[model samples]
Target chain A: MKRNDFDFSQPNKQSYAAIVFLAYHFFRILVRQLWPVLIAVLVGRENLKNMLFWIIAGISVLVFVFAVISYLRYYFYIDNDELVVVKGIFKRSRTNIPFQRIQTINIEQSILHQLLQVAKLEVDTAGSKGTEFSFSALSMAKAEALRQVVLEQKSKILPLPQTSGVEKISGSELALQTILHLSFSELIRIGATQNHLRSLLIILAFFMTLYNQVEDIGVDTDQVVDQINEEVVYFGKIAIIILGLMSVLASFTFSLIRTIIRYYDFTLFRTNDGFKIVSGLFTKKQISAKDHKIQYISWADNPLKRLLGLYDVYLKQASSSEVRDTKSISIPGCNSKNVERIKFYYVSPEEWKDLKNFKISGKYIYVRVLYFGILPAIILGSLMLFTDFKIYSLLTALWPLLVYLAFRVNHKKWNFAINHELIYIRNGIFGNYFKALRLYKIQSMALRQSIYQRKHQLATITIYTASGNINIPYVHLDLAKDICNFVLFKIESDKRKWM
Target chain B: MEFLNEQIDVKGLPDITDIQAEKLAANYLKVIFITRGLTSFIFITGIVVAAILLKDISVTIRFSVAGLLIILFIWFFSLSSKVFNTRSYAIRQRDIIYTRGLLFKSTTIVPFNRIQHAEIVSGPIDRFYNLSSLKIFTAGGSQSDLSLPGLLSSDAARIKSFIISKTAQDEEE
Candidate 1:
């Protein structure tokens, strides 16, 4: 299905619309580099104006020229089952990616691209570092056609077993079977329930940066602080309450806007090979992963999400060491039934039924409290006794109660299980999290014993996978050994591909 | 799959601690001492120079610096020997285990199937002593999971080739 409109026989440059894309990137870098000076200028730093203005203008001109040259120089073509990319203006660099090595071809469309009816294509390889190659701007039709060709070539190279029986359908038909979509109300709920502490930190960081910049421009921050303190004293408790409410409102609004922009029109579709997720508003993104490539499935729900009956499910795949986070796709707003359906798709019901649950030793609670509670309390208490901060010692007294609560949570949450095919772990600090992975997917296993653990005949077993590490701590040494051996046996004997 | 229902005998399973580990080369201790001596010499020289330049500096400060240096020297010497004695590595049919550390000992086991690559590297001092270090990398992280230093160059090369072959065999299966 080669398009006659765009010649595939020779190396092809991205559409001229790519110049706009390049210019935007160049402008972003320029703005980031010159932001301090720009802020200084805005703050009425008169002496530096002429110099800064000339410097910024010169850089902008250079960036524009470079963007044009880069757009002109970049070209790509497929030759003998390899995608060859020739780029760079002054120093030419060529990258050849074989079809078998291409892990995912992601098509993204920024607001500018949408306006121009073009798409950006990012090709990711199994390499651990970053995106292998990205074509900044291509016609929407051409980008989709190239994606199809690359995928077809990749299938020919690897020959996926599960794709054999499903009947091939056109692209339009394939996009129709959406597995999940987030409603506006669901998005609002997610936004409202976001971690407020994280957003507060971000807001604090922004103000801190601005304060630093103002100080650099010779503004007397001490005077400003004095004025603010006097105002606070004058306004008293009402001022404090108003400020708190305003900050909360600001954080909530920020979260809401972020959620709307990120999850707008989010959709997941099932294809013959695997699943495809399309999301984002300003910059649309499409990510697809095959069924067999999924290494594990996990879901987590905090107290707020639990109240809203929402669960965020993550499907992890074998990823490179550097970009492990990018390989997993998280689907928010999944109900219990949806979670079970996805679990069933990855693991058979028979295998799931065979799982034998095991709880960690009760001593784990004592150990955690000793390490995370009493140790800190001792240091703080000793500091208070030695120093003038005697009043602060009262905080140390509260550690025992905190430690008891932590112990209770630890004892309740730490559970693991193993079936014939998969291992399941349930853990979390303040929320419930569940992870399940096939035994064969584990790359390595280690049975470790600390001095205390050794004395108590307890061991910690760590299973390493490409995506992350799973630790089952404070289990009987004999049980840990048996589990380690069984995992190793399964890994060695299983003939199926782990990825 | 049939083994899923069967009771696994924990005693019958292979234990990493049971493996007879081979100690690093004797010359490795000499390399460690030389490096430590170089560092100590530089540190002592710096203190002496500072004392000489600041003549008005208190005698108490000089004496305390000397005392601290002595204590550090004793601690380093004692711990170095203990660490050297404790370091050992064992290569099994399916995995390699390296155990080290004197006070808080740790043993890292990396299976053949998990190893991304293996390399033999020799620093200037290692080259002088005809020794090399074998580094085994995995997809787990940026750093090599296991690095066994102070092996004769030939031994390192032989181990590297063996690991490479095992990795190839694992990949084929």
Candidate 2:
């Protein structure tokens, strides 16, 4: 079908794929809520277990029927430039969203949705509560048309700057450029750099569930462990070394497989409207961000990635909530040049080198040392006298480590710089995280001081933007005041839309 | 939209420290004391009832709980006044500045152009004292949002309208 083939003027139901998805959704929730009862009935006598199977089958059929009914009742349409969704079996409550209020439109296609030739559509609105509405299934072409229409209607209503000689770029001015793309080799490098501990945790959790299932089927896992222990005793430390090597190998493999699959051929495109990211192998997720919607840009690097001069860039798009909006988009495996280009897209194109760097006061380490080092060490030292802690030796060794970490984090890792147009923050221990934002985009500024800091004439300045907050802590009180005043002046002097 | 970035000396800019801020109403203190007094009374009553109902518990624990509650009440009552006295807000020519907290002092500034909306809020207790609060929201989240409490209803209404007047002018264009 053509892009505009669907009848948007008339109310339409979601694609037929919704029936299966809605049923699966409801079934999962039902099983999650009633798993204890199901487990109890299964552990009972054979006759009751047999009856429980049939009862579950009946419930599945009932749930499927209810999903179909719910799908039939739901209706969505656009009228008077407002998107309206009416859905309820008995209550029949209706929601009306003005075009101007709609923030972002997201489309996602999982493997199942791909098989069904449909996609999930999400609409996030801007407000205090940030109400979100999602449709389980819609034809790809129709979803695109819907998003385009909503964006067009929204752009028309929202006022744009018409004061300067610069003509506003419309859809007609579309010029798509490949801002950044990851090749197979780069993807491999990125996959290799993926947090292996997280992958290992996932593998362990999977095995744990499998082991629980085997135990439920009456397997003697304790006997298996005892056998392993016997083998370990025979091999001595060699067995432990081998086991450690095997776990590391398995974790690396798992991380590589997951990262490759998730970001097989990720491409970031710079469109006239904004930036569009298309990636994923089995599940295709597309994120588009308009220039106006982006609040700030941040890039971070780990020690491993830092070795390869690699950074993962994130566009912190304006969103009331991250869970529902999917507004923030992260692109991994970007080189320094790629990061610079992306940063220039959101922030000013001036050189950030000449800006004077302001480090957080050395007094900042006092609280960190007091709370983390002295307090914990004192507590553990006092407790060591009355209690035997051979089993808690690991806990005993933690205080010194905490103290060192506090010193490393606050002493050398903090730097804040600001020019007339934008602000930059660089912080982190071992690896660095950098954030840059336009000054006019700032919403509010606050300077805070604790009793200790108040006595020391130090304050923390927090700048709130549409996306999130950025804090520069333990600066001189006069510097904080000057920063707040200057930032407020920037925001007040400019007449531009933050998002 | 206009290119208005011009270099200026930072020293010449208007300072926020010079502006005078208005203190909270006296009735606000009474409101806090009454609410805290009621809570303290309930706790004391519960302790007395539990002490009588469970005679196995020693007098030390019973009296300790009561004493702790009383001490906490006194501490909070004193802190409330200190916090109230410390709290003040100033409506500047281009922004609003509010300073709060007793121990951890904080000052917030919100430019008029950045404000999303202004709300007047009053609960049952606030109305009993003929007082209300004005909440100012920006594109920023709750952390940066401003709420000025312990104001006469008429005063709150006036400030809200003043903010709305400044913010609405930008919207109209």
Candidate 3:
């Protein structure tokens, strides 16, 4: 069918007007700051001659407000196999989305949506870079019903089962599964090692942005810098001590918030169609995977988690999002107890036996430490400290030394389960995680060796799944080859679509 | 479709074959000549105009910038030529192999079944030379996708159609 042939209508917003308003205001606030940015760039100072900057800023703000009004006025609909998006102030574009190619439809409601009783719909298709259709605000009930109807229509042509084959497992079993996987102490550790350095960098960047904004308004940045400098001298010793304490507190706070938001009373349940994952404390997120679409399962334990015996579990599916892959659930704090529960819950009991049989040896850990841990640390550290221009000179020496030792300890804790039915691997520090996947689901497998690895007779096996690749690093070359060959054999033998 | 053995048929996989570099080299040079002619013209004009207008700027900085441009031009030329000459793809009975690298050699193979689509693209220069580029898309990410430049237009078309037919037949089964 042609792109425009299908009839499209905007989904009715059952009663989410307030939520829409909230989202609108959020966007408006962001747009309001654009002028301050542009003026800062053009004038190179806060104040400009003839009040031109303010005039320009005022005009721009009016234009932005008009744009927001136009956007808020927009609505859309889908009917008779076509998606219709009605948007624009003067001229409207009623974009049509065909039902034939749609792969999946999901309804997501943020906290605002939940409070307002509205949800957003995301429609995805195979091979498409972005969603084919999206509705910002719709009634929750209508969204689900519409999603089902569209999904059913799409499934008729796409060849997947129309009905989700969710198996209903006992709530007690689910609670057991949750208990088996969740570890309170391990959660704290995972939060601690969450690579907050990136977040810290982002915070620093935000502070710089605020500083720039202040400067743009014609404030003397030199004055602010001087003020900071004066403060440092006025209370130099106290400032240093306070900074140290503040840094520690900030790190812990970051960890605590992340844990509370991500894993807060997370639970996994078995439904006829697939496994249902319910997580998040403030605004719960429920995700389900078709039994057939799951590509991999992984869990890992970070250094702290390892010390506390914690494990984080993740299910990698064919469809992925930023948070889906990143935010994993604590299967039950750092331990082997929940491993069996996870295997049996997702995989068959027979598969569970096979999973248990597969082992991770000490040799693998030693090789991982020698190559992945020590060697890279030394090289990176030396390179950073002894570089030609001496950038990151001090950080290079101190950071790597600490990182190397930490990684070494973490690598020694690495473990994997390679059975006839599934391949599971667990690694990571503070952010402990475990991933498991059916052998048949692996789309591709590769055995790679760097020149250095080759010299040491070490190889890294990367098993490709739909979500991403999972690597078992620094295994003996012989073991790597064997696993690679076995994976290839399994992948080829299975008639299931790994794609 | 069923298991031939309880293992991957490693014996069936093809070994890497050396591809002819002349076609690639010729295309690379033509592209380089066109790009250099346009960019150098722009750069020279910019330098002359800027030198005349910006009297406060030192002559040394301008000359140094010009030198930097020359170095960049040489680097781009060398890099492109090396990449063009080294990159070549081969097709086996069941899979297509692409070999490329200036420093670290990489050979990637995609089986016929895995190919999502194949396209034949001919630019103005390529049309002039009766050559086209063939891109083989797979379900995998961009890195695993294969591109073969500087093929005879007819050959590229023939291969494209062949792959399409093969894929259609497999899917129908």
Candidate 4:
């Protein structure tokens, strides 16, 4: 540490050590990726070329050394009013953030950082992407001490009570809440149904690619296909086994890497402002919002997870006018009991009581399942019938179609919602999500009557919240308008500050 | 900031007087009904789109869509004229009120301190008729954020200046 430059506000040694460790591992991974090219060049039977590869490797090593030096040299200081960071090579850049604008401070440590006994500090402000400032790798104790100091300084400038007059609970209570809500089974189910369908399809495509690669390298593609078609694959059993194993391993590796990167040691901590979420391994992320920033809260419980009483909750926060796209932050694997507790943080008990519980009308479920299944089947069947195909073509298509229809039916059966304290929606087949959002956060309301709906005297009332839009379909048109008017009246009449 | 303590205590918000409510609710129904014309124009465009998309449908379907479109157009025109002539305002000890709706009546009450910004806007239609709309913004995230619409330009200007002065005076305390 630079003793003279270092003041009481500077980070401790553990933080620097952690950053150095991170840089070391990252550099090592980079070198490993480039190793094969260097080995190929070295073994090309040209002495001069081999020497060039060695020189390049030497340069890479030098770069690694420089990266470490930079990480170690970087330092920051916190004054009463602002946080100043002095960092760079060749030219030092000093960045200052005012204390009053400080939104929240997050402390995060991944498994690697945990092993190193270091934690990272991130300071987030409104409208800033990621944290405005991050203090890399410090001892957890020192990180907490520094965090406390910063918080104290910030409070002096803002002078607002940390939690806006909410009850504060012990860490043990938080830990219990975390454990009760965090369901591993739900996470796995979520992993399965998630956008991973795209990945699963991609993985299947990758397998075909690998299969073609093997064929191009010498294996006979025609013989392999013929064997599978004829059910006579004795000649290439060993090769088939090897290929199957390779594909499985590759897919598993892809899934594992994706899951690790997206949700490595994800944690949520209750804070005075709201909940703080910390996740990520390589490029860590932290998000903090006050209760008022949240526009809607929703949750999902999948079929298998529902059996195990597992679900996930998400808070959709308002989009800043400066940025059009907004995202929802989720606390995955939450149990049913935690949903109410989480809602309690944002709404009063009386307001919570006003939320209406809505279940998918049986007629709607029938409509959804029929539309999802029969419509596609009819369209595909007609098109296929018009084209050249055998009698069994429809039957062959029936397999995936039937499976999808079953899933759709199951999904629609489970979707429901209510408007009481907040509007709560429960959706999904295997995993159930119960989400409740306060009405006051809605930016606009529209009662839309489609020609089909109008004939039925029904309309879809869409509540456009700051974050996103939610539509309650097939309600009586007059009732929808009445509800819309009621909501608009209440929203305009309220004097509460949302942000 | 201390000026807010003197203008009107915000703690008095919950109980609004009937006179204040009536004052704010004035011309609300007329303006709301008139705005239906604007909404009908928008809705008719959807009917035209449907007619084009579902061309292979029966004559009855086509006739129905066309009829709905024509009816909505007429409704829009009928309401448009009435909206301009309507106006209303209400006042409570803690807040001011405004209400506007046609068939479905809606009312809005804004506390004195809750006003973040206010604007008086006029378009070609309003300019021709000597009418303006007052849009008041608060910090909250509600879509019903706008308080009143369809006022005489002069009335809107007076309200804006009054609110501004009131805000300034409240801050002085």
**Best candidate (score: TM-score):** 1
> Which lDDT value does model 4 have at A352?
53
Q: State which candidate has the highest DockQ.
A: 2
| All candidates: TM-score of chain A | 0.91, 0.85, 0.70, 0.68
In model 2, which regions exceed 4 Å deviation? A1-3, A45-53, A128-130, A159-173, A196-254, A321-327, A351-354, A390-409, B36-73
Q: Rate the local accuracy (lDDT) of all candidates.
A: 0.79, 0.81, 0.60, 0.59
DockQ of each: 0.34, 0.54, 0.11, 0.06
lDDT of 2 by residue, A83-179 (tens): 9898876789789889888877889999999999999999978774636789889988788788888777666776543322235564332677998
Superior candidate under TM-score, 1 versus 3: 1
lDDT of 1 by residue, A359-470 (tens): 9988788888888888889888988988898888988979967987967886789889997688999988777899999887777776667778878888878887777777
Candidate 3 chain A least-lDDT 10 residues: A170-179
List candidate 1 segments past 4 Å from native. A1-5, A35-63, A128-131, A161-177, A323-326, A385-389, B1-13, B36-73
Q: DockQ for model 3?
A: 0.11
lDDT of 3 by residue, A1-499 (tens): 2122222354433334534554465456665866676556666554556567676667556666655665565665667766556666667766666776564565666787777777777766544544355666667766666666566555554565322223343211132223333346545666775656665666678789999878768889998799988998999899989977887777677767877677765666655545666666666665555555555666665555566565556665664332233223334343566655665656767555545323333445455455565677667767766667466554545654565566665565577777666776666554656667777665445555565566677666666555666777777766665666565555544445553
- In candidate 4, clashing pairs total 43
For the second chain, the TM-scores of the candidates in order are 0.87, 0.83, 0.72, 0.65
- When summed lDDT is taken over every stretch of 10 residues in candidate 1 chain B, the lowest stretch is B1-10
Give the candidates in order of TM-score, highest first. 1, 2, 3, 4
The CA-based lDDT of model 1 is what? 0.79
**Which tens-of-lDDT digit does each residue in B68-139 have in candidate 1?**
886787577656767788889989998888877654456667878878888888999989999999998876
